[model samples]
Target: MFIIIPQTPQNYALRIKQHAERTANLDIRSGVNYRGLAGFLNRPFAEDHRDATVDVTNPAEPPLVCVKSLVEGGRQTARSYHAVSDCATFEQDPPSLVNKAAHLVWLQGYPAPEWINAIGAQYRVDPEFFRRHLIFLQSKDNHDFAAMPSSAQRMLTLRLTTICHTQFALRQTAIEAARNEATNAVRQHQQRLRTGDSVVRKYSVFDNTIFTIDQELAIYVERKKQHNGWIAIVCSDLGKDLTQGPGGLSSPWLGEEPASPPACEPVIMHVPKLALKHPHQHRFVNVTSNGSPLMYQNASLLADTIDLQSGGDDIYLDVREALHDVFTLIAAAESQFLTMVQGLVDREIQLQSSGKQTEWTLSNLRYFKSSIDDHIVNLENTLDFLRHPDVPKWAPHTRSPRALSREGTPAGQAQHSRYRSPQGEAFAEYSRLSSLGDDYTRLLQRATKLSNRCVENTTILMNMAMLEESKKAIVQADGLTRLTLLAFFFLPLSLTTSFFGMNFRELGTGSMHMWVFFVVAVPFLLFSTLLCFWGAVLPNFRGRMQWAWKMFTSGAR
Candidate 1:
């Protein structure tokens, strides 16, 4: 149902320019002509698209695109898989769904500019709505995905899945590795200090280690903002086929008259897959299920749920259920994030409790502080999204009251009738979303508290590091003072010896007695010793001297 196809970069600016020129007269507003439009389109995502001279030598790898189809025949609903190797073909002459059908067509990938217009035309969407959709895609704003924008006539579903476990695991590994390296570096530095090596060399090692870890964390946070984003569209007229009453679509395949394909296309969805740029980048793997990528598996599961629950008969119920499923994925992502933050909190606690906080450099504290701050900002954004009024109200019922009244009526007095009102289902879904929101709120609170704890721990680590530095400085000053005093005490003795060793005439003729040299050296050595003792007690003398200086200055004044 899902596969990857190579998509090299094309002249996107030229495409937009041509399209804008063709549609120039449609909008007569000042500065709303082809040039402006082209400029606007060029600004988003790939700004290099604006430059005609830019080379496309390093084209990106292929990205995964999913195309799924569910069609109705006489007595059964048949499912099929499709792959669009040529996006142009998929856009201009897309595969059709049965007109008299209760089927679902899901296409997931990024659409070319022309493809966006084609989707608008196929869905009978308002040109204005599709233009906004086009701009939405062009903007590539992740926050909009979180906001879940929609229009009454079109069901625009945009979702940003959590960071894939592969990527998350890689980042976690990086975090742990950095922590271990810093820990080891700290130990080595302490050993060097004990062995009397130059402190400056060990300082460099610590600085480099911390800087590397900080850079890694910075990258992690930056990439965190850009998780796998997805957009899905459900046509407003999807329920029209169901309006034709029970037995599904009247298809040529059923009567066996050469079984021609249906005239209408299936509902297409788009998912722009990112190319892997590094060894540790996202890779397709089993996420919460086996044998398929996470989003694809999720899509399949969603299709299965629709097939089972509403039997693909009620579009409203289908959308409701789909949105609920999406929220479930979001909730799971949030829980995972919470767990990650908790791990960080625990690590900080471990570092502190194990007495390693004293060894932590300011750089180490900086990484944690940056990590905590980034997560808090991200969590606050997520929490705001969860608490947004629009979240619970998503996929609201758009049917007329009369239709609702008709659907609400019970199907006879049968005890086990499968007659569930759309209203009841909507209420149930709303309640589910609200409950999920509450859970997210609790998770956010926990994450916030954990982040705050990390902040506190960072502060403690900073203080401890400062204290350690102060202690080291004090010890160094004490050692220097001892060395200075020792040197000074022996200074006079050295001077006296040097003076007596000089080749003087009196000394050469043995006119000078050896006791004269001893007498002179002894008094000088004693005087130096007394001076060392006086300097040792110099602080006491300084306080008295300061008092005396104040009195003297006061008298002078």
Candidate 2:
């Protein structure tokens, strides 16, 4: 007979297969059983007992049994035959009968409640005592327990029932906790998300800030690049590193080759001369290869070609120098961006640590605003000059009234005189007043906006801080309340000690012996009363006392 059990969701078939493969040297495959139960038993469950008896007194053991049957034409023939058991016939013998009884009970669906009750009755214990010791056995490929032994199978069924009940209870608690955590997480994320607009505005402000910084950096990079280009050009012109000879100067220890004199190398000298005189020297020389003084003609042609090539090489070097400067400027711009980003990040961190938000500082923003205003002003001034009728058409021309007067006294001198002075003065005054008014207006607008933003942010932070402080106060108050309750709990003891300390001889005939006895007896009585008070009275009084305190404080406050 065999017992069947279903698989649990938590079970991992591949892991079980791996474990079996490692421990038993078996190639256990996953999925529905491909191999027979016998192979699985031999590989993974090899430790399972075939013929074992268990003592029924030990809750860890379940009843077991053996079967004997005679088959005719593949049909079982039931006959009364002696079968092995787990209960002993005698006290000293192993409990073979108990194992047999348990196995029989297991074959009939384990009879969970009945088995638990029977075990409890026999051991004079609770049903849970027997159920807890039970272990579940499962199939290798699937978690099905159909092939397990009868006695072991019954224990497994009861174990599963108990575990499922426990897991169900735990799952409910976990689900509740998870729901609460998710609620809190959503609330927190929502709070952060609400700040998204502010964050975007901050980014825009930061962009403008960095734009101003980059303008300065661009100027610096351009200057540095130009300086670097000049240095490179100067170095190239000085013939530095232009030789094909040994790097710089060769070491004396290395044997030096004898230098060939220019005179001995007559062909070298003559070729340079011929090349200098003839523009198409190489073509001419090729045509007159058999002509007289061929070596001298070749030398002259070679020299001219060398000089031209040298000049072209110088130009190439200058171009390369300029390219290096541009690359340097590009590299500097990249470095400046990195530096600026790092600085901004550091400033943000500092502000956060100091309990301030990044938006509170308008320094960078103000700088950018000022730069834009200045740029606008400069553009307007240039436009004004371009529109001016009397402005000089070109450089080096005078446009002053005195120059105009020196050229010729116009017939409309009185008209020029009539409008010039007053118009010029009015224009000057108007320009100054207009600029002042514009500057003042812009300053006022920026200041007002900044002030309003500050006030709004301050209000938000203050409210948040107050809320946090209130929460902390509530927690502290709770702790203080507990301490106060504890202190009040010992009030009776304190009162008793204080009462005993006072000399009270008003009761009966006062004597020295009575006084001494009162001193000892009163304390002993109070101590016993306190113990009884703590054990019984405190539990009863706790709710009432807490209520009274709440009422009294509510009224008093």
* TM-score (all chains, Cα) for each model: 0.48, 0.18
Across residues 1-557, which tens digit of lDDT does each residue of candidate 1 receive?
Answer: 96653232234444545565653357543222334335443443354643222122111211212233333332334232222224445455443433323223332222333333344334433333333323322322323223233432233322222221111122334444545565455334323221101111111111211221110000000001111111234311111111021222221111112122112111122212414333232232223232221111222223223332332333322333334444454455445545654664576578677876434433444554555455455556545544443322233334323335544446322211332243333332233445656766776677567667766777777777789899999999999989988897678878987787754455675456677887888888777777878856688889999999999999999
Candidate 2 residue 61 C-alpha distance from true site, Å:
92
lDDT of 2 by residue, 64-89 (tens): 11121112122222111111232223
Question: Candidate 1, TM-score vs. the true structure?
Answer: 0.48
lDDT of each: 0.38, 0.28
lDDT of model number 2: 0.28
Q: Model 1 off-target regions past 4 Å?
A: 1-81, 85-117, 120-321, 356-386, 390-429, 502-509, 522-557
lDDT of 1: 0.38
Residue-level error in angstroms, candidate 1, position 531: 5.7
Give the CA lDDT, 0 to 100, for residue 187 in model 1.
Answer: 38
